[model samples]
Target: MPPTRPSAVPPQGDTGARADAYATAPLLNCLLREVARPVPGAGEPRVYRLPSGERLLRVRGGRRPAAPEVNAGGTWHRVGHAELVKLVAEELQAHTGLSNPELPAEMADSRDAVAALLTARDRTTPPDDPYRRSEQSLLTGHPYHPAPKARGGGPVAAWLPYAPEAYAAFPLVLLGVREDAVAEEGDVSALDAFGTAPPGYQLLPAHPWQLDLVGPSLTDAFADGRLIRLGTTAFDTWPTAAIRTLYAPEHDLFVKFSLDVRITNDVRRLWRHDLLKLRRTNTAVSAAAPSVTPGAWLSDRGYRTADFAFEELAVLVRDGLHTHLAPGTTPLLAAALVESFDDTPLDGLHDPAAWWTAYLRAVVPPTLELFARHGVVIEAHLQNCLIAVDATGTPVQALFRDAEGVKLLPEVSRAAGWERLVYCLVVNHLVEIAEALCERHPDLDPWPAVRTAFERQSLRLDLPEATALLTAPTLPGKTNLLLRWTGADGADARYLPLPNPLRAR
Candidate 1:
């Protein structure tokens, strides 16, 4: 569908009164409805009583509709029919890939309905929507965008060309092919595509199931008693890791290859296994996506052989970078910075939101093209970021790594699993660390500064042209958490300052 102006409430006559009115509105009900909580009928909007005893209006339904439910006041409210239809259609599409039922009777009529909705967008009442942005634009950080075609070339110097000499440092080279290559190979193994190997070349079987989607390739290679493993450690979660490279001089990629997969799948050591596999995937894709650095697998199979253990690989990062900041100074330094300034953590967050900026610069436009105008909630924090600097202690790039650390909007994910994702990505990581910064720098607009930092990261990724996603939700908002946190002095900290206004709504 063509992009409509993002939904927003019109400015009222006075700023303070309007803000106060929104502050007293039934924001929680709005969030619940957005999350697809059932509501009453169409004519009757969901009437919710705010904490301050103010009343607010809520309705659901759009191109996709939410579940219908009865409200506490015994009044009837349903996800507005318009919104309900939209969300339900989206949900249906997610499950069966059919936006509407393939009913013989209404199939033809539904076309008219779709056309009307598309045409009458301006007249439609917008539903409760949260701030969101896309991240596919983030691919530019390290030059992972596919190289432009050579004017006239039989073969050009692409980064990972199929060559034997390039295989010297690492013996076994894992190559993942896009699905088309698999069909080209037919029944033949990935090895057959490149012709017979020179002496010391061995074509290990690519994972059988992956061969159809991601192309097959040589799994391992041995040169002078050294083993190099390649392609990827993960083949299922994503469709990409069809090949991996294991390369190290004088070390067997897997000393006991036969027993390796079995031990790593063991239950108890799962965390270690996840760490190794995640690190390995991060290493390869970082280069593939062209992020912070391109990390490849290396060999270190001797000392540890526990369940979830995978062989090690050397990831190629800039020479002087380390993952963390200077020792001991990290947590305290973060807190001290916030405290010295006398500002709150939220103040340091980005204004137009840095996550959206970098994502637009790095991942979108020419590469992914998934979103037209996106709003990505970056969720950057200590654990999700690497504060890399130069020789003079000047900050360079705030490396945003870890795919699992970011949260996409509910519309993108479809499932309402956002709460957990938000908890882990935003509150758990970025806010937690920013809280320390705020404690030290009380005078700073911590949130906006953080947003500015996100913008800096975006600029590093070459996204200066795109827009950012930093506007807070414009509707009435509130938060009512069920749990509390205890402070260092053992005082109740459960009544935390919640970020989203609609949380209580």
Candidate 2:
């Protein structure tokens, strides 16, 4: 049977073209990286041979590849987002010796989601603060995931108002859980600052979207008075790149909630297991913060939830920028540097090499030293990192966050942990930044500066893994596309070796 197409037709005019472009870049990136072998030739448009079905594919541009075409019947034909999804489905099934009905649908849903976001963005005004704008600028998220923008296949109306890409900000629903039923740990006192609870209750803020999702499950809790609706917060919280996490600028606080939506790979819930381990993880990362120096760690301070609905209604309090950020330095999401935005530091870069070197200095030392000295493996991917730039748009400091994704040493074998670090730091973080910079300044070679940064850190920290990284022929590249297609755990990261740019030519 031919593949099923997405329900929503592509939007009309320039919006349609833009939706296609935004959606196609990441899907093409995944296909090219994981499954397609480069065809030996250089020209205006690059070509690749899909080994699974022996099909030929071509695309123009680098960094964010666009205008995809497939060769069939002795001619190359342009393929839109829907057709691209079909082609990916066919290639994956053939390549993996497996079939997946869900992924194709998700790919379609993701494309449709982009269209919705583009439309919503037209009507909304982006945040005035550059930092907030950077935080919300991930239009094409997770550059290698097939359905990075997929919103659990829900209606646009259901999710659009809360979408960060659409510059969304709204008040969080406040609930009062009976004191006896409240389960919490550490410094969750930050949550109580939102609003007051009645005589026998405690304040618990919940993501309105999450409440909409798990409302049915909490019906009895509400009926029995375990949970009471106390109305929404008076102030608004801007949704961050991580949709489940929101930033309350008024309070200078970040609150993460258990969203039962499948974003990217996992159902993004504050899982019981992760929450149980949250204190231990946060403590360890906090203790390791000194090793990063001027670079800092945004510790997940604590979490709060009702015992009856632990995972469904749980909320985590994270350290906000005001406390951790250096005086006068502006923190920009690291992902935004690669994704690009209005007035992004990279946009007006006068010296690409110097800018990149400063970036490496801010980001690399902290990531490696934590692993080497403190035995902390932070998931220092772009989203989890914030690069604080000075007034002149030069990167001055790096701040890392998300304890839920942090892995400590000894708990994980050194080898396993090192591999994870390399993938997250080098492949996921540095490669994207370098490519984006090089794309902008084609005359500059970003890798040598990267190599120097790594070598200097290896010597400074005496990290053997860092030394080995320089000579290594291949870097571990996460296979996001195949992982999703095979229905693997999102945490169960499988890597394919890509030619290491750090290695001397």
Model 1: per-residue lDDT, tens digit, 1-505? Answer: 1112111112334333222222112122223423233324534444332222222334433211123433435464543323333433343344344433322112122222222222232243321210001110110111100110111111123212211111111123243322221211112232333223334443232322222212222232223223333453322111110012211112211111111111101111113333344433433334333322211111112222111112222111111122223332111111111111122222334432332233223222212111112223332332233332233323223434333222344434522222333343344444534433333344533455445544554455544321232343322111211100000121111222344421222
What is the clash count of model 1?
109
lDDT of each: 0.26, 0.88
Looking at candidate 2, the ten consecutive residues that score lowest on lDDT are 1-10
Estimate the lDDT of model 2: 0.88
What RMSD does model 1 have? 22.2
| Model 2, span 28-105: residue lDDT tens | 999999999887864668989885655799898776788889996669999999999999999998898899999999
Pairs that clash in candidate 2: none
Give the CA lDDT, 0 to 100, for residue 379 in model 2: 93
- Measured by lDDT, the strongest candidate is 2
User: Candidate 1 — which residues are off by over 4 angstroms?
Assistant: 1-268, 271-284, 291-381, 400-425, 451-497, 500-505
Clashing pairs counted in every model: 109, 0
